[model samples]
Target: MIRLLEEMEQERRRMNELGQALLEQSIPLSEHDELLALSQKVDQLMMQLHYAKVEQTERQYVRGGTNFEAPSMV
Candidate 1:
């Protein structure tokens, strides 16, 4: 899970770099499309990482039998 999170962070950095580069330079038409696709890919990767973390947390909660109780206030 940590590895997945790291990978997702790396991809996000790459996406940011790409955006910066696009703003600083005039890229060709094909390069624009390619960068857009890469951005979309990064978005998808982030979503997958988020879901993986959520699932892992759920599994841990279930396996550990964690109990949640409301506190009583007088």
Candidate 2:
């Protein structure tokens, strides 16, 4: 669980770096294509982070046994 969260965080940091670089640099069209790929990677990382959170929640509930229940939004 910790490891997954760490990986997610690392990816997020990398994504942010790429985004800032894209904004600050005035590169060629070919380089923009590469930056676009990094943007897609960011999307994929976000999905991974979401799923990891869900799985971690489930694991926590299971470990807590019958005492656990999903929280009410209200």
Candidate 3:
């Protein structure tokens, strides 16, 4: 989890650098091909982190026994 978070942070920093570069070059962000690719990668990492957290929660619940239920939002 720590490793994934670190990697995600690194990717975000890279994306920021790319965005700055595009702005400096007067290139439209939407038209930057590499930015689009990097954005997709960051999104994937976010999803991975989300799923990992969910899985960890489920594991904790299982370990706590079958009667454990997640709290309702409402």
Better by lDDT, candidate 3 or 1: 3
- Residues 1-74 of candidate 2 have per-residue lDDT tens digits of 56656766776687677667766775443466665775676677667778987887888788884455688899
Candidate 1 local lDDT, 24-59, one digit each (tens): 787653568767777787788778888987887788
Alpha-carbon RMSD of each model:
3.4, 4.6, 3.8
lDDT of each: 0.77, 0.69, 0.91
Worst 10 residues of 3 by lDDT: 60-69
Ranking by TM-score: 3, 1, 2
Which residue pairs does candidate 2 place in steric collision? none
Q: Highest TM-score among the candidates is held by which one?
A: 3
Error of 3 at 21 (Å): 1.6
Candidate 2, residue 40: how far the Cα is off, in Å: 0.8
Clashes of each: 0, 0, 0
TM per candidate comes to 0.66, 0.50, 0.82
